[model samples]
Target chain A: MSDAEERKRAYRLAPCPAYDIEGTESWLEDMAEKGLVLSGDGFFAGVACFWKTEPRQLRYRLEAAPEGTGLWSGNGGLPAEEAVEINEAYGWKYVANRGQFHIYCTDDPSAREMHTDPDIQALALNIANKRARANMITALIYFMIFPLIHLRGGVLLTAVHMGSGLMLGGLLLVLIALGRTVARVLHLRRLRKRLSAGEAPHRKNWRRRALYHRRSRPIFIGLTIIWLGFFFQGWSNENLGGNIMPLEEFTGQIPFATLADMVPAGERAGVILFNPWIFQG
Target chain B: MPRKALSGLTESMFYVLMALCRQPMCGIEVADFVDTKTQGEVRIGPATLYTILGKFEREKYIEVIEVSGRRRTYSITAAGLGAYAREIRRLQRCLDDAASEESQLGRESRE
Candidate 1:
């Protein structure tokens, strides 16, 4: 692959959690001079994409974020257009948004940093946390609903016996995501407190090292392949089911004397018959 | 957190207000002026200046006098002047209190 194409390929699978916005901003700046300008990121889709651009160092910063307005409505608290206008006046051009966080970049050699005061930065982070927690709550509900309804209504004994790797994988995803979300929320609250108390935010030491974009692509591709397999399996089972009770086999000449006589009567023995979607005569 | 008013302005805030009091200036100009005024001791980052400018304008401490493309020239309002004066008084009080306390210590030591 060409250098730009290789960077583009690497860009699609990288994810930086919301709690590490500053770290991700620094990472983006580092990536930008290498010709991969951060064009977009999907907090909901869990990926970040970059655009091939000329090689020039640019500073990246996260700005006014929506409380919890999903990816499409990154409108956060301040309207994006207005935010852009205001920020542009300050020399920071709006790049794109991730979740509710608005990203900006500037190439001005003398451009002032977008975030100067630690206290304001801390407050912005706290606001972002509130939105993140809201999103997490929704995601948590979805995780619970999926297992409770589709995964045999939370019957662990039955689910375990079924032995579906997909089920186990989904559950693991939910657990890991939940743990990470909860941890982030707690950390944000603490950091917010320290910032409010006038102490400089000292969180870099505890931050998770940014996952290399190039390294994560294969893992992401593997997950996508597994998901497609599950989807096809479901589609096949629905449309190409094995059991079929042909209508041609049961002729109108066959008459039942009575409903009770047709079916064997002895405590109404229930025969579990297979049902199929498409029947062929 | 509640917005900090005139009583508790930081060094950067004080210098920014001081810079605006002299003349209308854009963010870049203000930063440069402050750097010159403080002799490189107090350096205001561009990002920090951008934030402070927005805030000062919002609080009516400063008013935009002119906008030329991305550059905006801001002049201190009456309120900003008052804030600067109050901050100066606060520092003066601290110095006066320190000087008196030192004199008392000297007398006590002599006795």
Candidate 2:
């Protein structure tokens, strides 16, 4: 195979900085200028696949897909067929979509901007704002419920008993996810407010923002994988009785002593009180 | 989908309904009608137009008359006509009230 044919597909961390619509569109256009065109298949596993092609300018626009279009319910990341037809007629080709953000591309410079009215665009973004708010609530509920669910030994105690590195990593992951969700919600709200005030969507400079995300994504992914590893290890240990030992076998400093330590072994001979086995880290 | 109560039409919504009242029109045709009728004062984006279309359809304010290659032509329903008529009356009343107030002020100034 020829060099270009051999290297047909290239994958990059999707340069969507928390649904910054203009930034993402600019970043995708920038990618096309670098001969890395976004593939029609779209992003998978947070990585966008691009075709290695000759450098060219492509205008990428991100349109917000409102709820109940069934696009979110596993319609293969494509917008409604009717929506696609309408966009295509206006010279914009429907590309891949990520969640509610549908990406469109056009080489035509005069593709009559996807959305002509800011007020309408704001209405579309309301869906995203609602979704973000829902996510923030969910994250908040998880943040509250998680500690209570793990309250038997407490999250920190469990960390110490199970795997400190793993538990800490998991905690960090959850905190980051929650923070991201809240940030997205706030950003969407602000954008909607601006749009409703009749302000057009601004084209933000994507270079610096894209650079920061590209640098940070790999580290974030690595940490996530490590956290996942620890999570599964802990899960297996719990179910398979791995690292479980009787209290007497535990050599670590015991905060509380059992009945055997408090009373004479002969005095407690026939009666069994509490199970003395502890799951050790 | 459960129908939402109409709480007064926005300028765009009112224009869209007005455009549909003339005859059945597709999305692009409706957009064009609104643009031309307002002499470009009011412009409806594609997303907004579709959103309004979807909403109107849900509220029984419009019905699809033709579906040719994703270009669905819609006509205003009886409910939609009623809404448009109500809005027109509402606007007329506002104009009448303003005219009356201005004439009363003129008479008071003359006195």
Candidate 3:
């Protein structure tokens, strides 16, 4: 093997937990024995082959590149359009093409391999968990904090009066939970897809997800209760006060009520007050 | 010092502390260096990477260095270096013990 090939092998062997070279190689060997020709650029592209099975699987040979060659391109190597076209021709999904290197995945064989890889699935789950956590935190901050700070009345009042803060906070928390649930559901759906298609078991961060859910559930529920109590009180006060008090009565105690009353009395009230003789006649 | 406490750290956080031992690196550069060194063994997703970096910054393990323009860089503090050294020693001791066990096992098998 050449230097590039050696590096590629090393990369392949570097405990991805995503792709299983041994299993993939065995599958490839079986296919080759049954008359599939496996060929590709060892350094840039790892493996490639065409299968003659019932469904007809297309495979791309892959090898890890150290300086980051074709398997995962960086910038300035192959034209993106050309790389995409090539990937399509070989039935590969274009992942990314940067710095002349191109990465692609195949729905047929590549998907199968990926489905069987524990590491890749774990990575995906990790990504999803991270996203869910971030969104949850953001929702907590925005819904819980923003309204508490800058509402018309005040944080506590808004929580009690308008219930806007609580409502908004509840909405945010629910949305975040929903988002996390959606992510988990999607992850499960992917797992199901792989399983139905006869793929191996993949690693999942169920423990972490469970822990996160456990930690967040109480906090979310507590916040909801607190905010809801405040919001309802505010809304009730606003409602009762609105129904009971007329605008005139409501404004009477206002500091600027006299100023408003003086505006519509025709001639300048201020002038008349300053010079009583002018209006006395 | 505590396994439970360390367990709370994400893998990137652990790597970030390791990276900081050499020198402080800005978020982007630290991420890039990790990717390069690991040769893609660890691919830090953008959001996770930034969030962890922010936490570290908040904790004072790393401090912002340059904020000239849109780009901000960070470097490890003295405290961060000390923490990194401690972690390295811990790992080294574990490796040494493991190696010794393997050697003893080999001798026993030969006998």
Candidate 4:
């Protein structure tokens, strides 16, 4: 197989992040049931690697790292070595991790549920919320700053140079990233409120929401494909001076005055006289 | 659980503290004891058990007496016993108050 094909074989991106952890876990479980087991996960929010295997019943758990729990930075950093050691001790094999939540899976049906107490689950989610809020602040900073850099001069002029398609593609990506981040933060806040009220977190769980829904996965995958296509198309059309050269514009400076100037009525459109750059009849 | 577990001990927490007061047991054993004592009525989630154990340790209510393989044995401290006894007394008082009210109501009915 070619190198590109091999690389494609290795990685398949998921539709969401650990913030939509419930959906991701459920999705992973479904994948596992289908004999595609998630073996590793990368840093990118939507990236997950899988291994083909015999179908088996598997249970996946996502736990928000409690405050002062994770070994390293705490406050929702990572699951520490000790934490992994302890979880392994408890028969939970570590599967993957993203942001504040650590993922684990066990095939034992009677291995016991990850969370028995809703109150403690709520507290763990609270710790995760602080981290989620922090991420949103960081996103807010970038969201505000990114547009300023792009909109430095003016929108119309930028659009003309960058190609409206290109700009729109970028804007689409930014809006999506912002939307997902904001939605996750809001979901956490709602969960936290329910938890603090001594209500169960699973009542109207965030897993089945639109953001984490199975149907939304296709939309995200489609968007990524479109974004990549548009971005590459724009990238290839770029000029040396950093100005965009759209596919329509030819090397000649003069715009097509009339269809007869270049069509069968005038001359053959293929040949170009390249002697010191001059158009000849 | 609640921020102030002292205010009202959750049934699981209360049992955990109660079991530990009697013997130094590992996590699974504690869970088993609770299940058996309640005649399989109350079930503790592993996550909840770990969280409660961690909190109890943090508060010095329970101290780790031994670690054998993956199992860490914990026994209740003086504070844990005190808390458990206090909760029991509170529950007893409430029950006693209900009985007294019932007797008074019975006397009124007789009249």
Tell me how far the alpha carbon of residue A228 in candidate 1 is from the true structure, in angstroms, after superposition: 10
Q: Whole-model Cα lDDT per candidate?
A: 0.64, 0.76, 0.49, 0.68
Clashes of 2: 0
Fnat per candidate? 0.24, 0.41, 0.00, 0.46
- Residue-wise lDDT of candidate 1 within B1-111, one digit each (tens)? 785553467677888999988888877778778879889777775445655666677779999888775556789999999989999999999999999999999999999
What would the per-residue lDDT of candidate 3 be over residues A1-281, giving only the tens digit for each residue? 67764433212211111123233434444444455433333222222324233333444322121123333334333323322332343345444322212334454653323222333333333433444445557866776557555655565654464545455766676676667556655654565456445464523333333445445645666776786676656646655674366666674566655655755566676776677675686
Tens digits of per-residue lDDT for model 4, A50-75: 76778878888878865533335653
Q: Write the per-residue lDDT of candidate 2 for residues A1-281, one digit (tens) a residue.
A: 48866589898886556478877787788889999988877776568889999999898888887652233454544576667776776778888876558888999987667776666677678766676567567755665346425643576677776667666667677787678767777777788888778877646787766667776767777888876666667767777888689977989987887666866667663444443532231
| Each model's Cα RMSD | 9.9, 6.8, 17.4, 11.0
> Model 3, which residues run further than 4 Å from truth?
A1-281, B1-10
Q: Which RMSD does model 1 reach against the true structure?
A: 9.9
Rank ordering of all candidates by TM-score, starting from the highest:
2, 4, 1, 3
The lDDT, on a scale of 0 to 1, for candidate 1 is 0.64
Best by DockQ: 2
Q: Of 2 and 3, which scores higher on TM-score?
A: 2
Candidate 3 lDDT at A220 equals: 65
Per residue, candidate 4 scores C-alpha lDDT tens digits across B1-111 of 545544567777888998897789988788788889999788776666777887788778999888765568899999988889998998899999999999999999999
TM-scores of the candidates are 0.54, 0.76, 0.34, 0.59
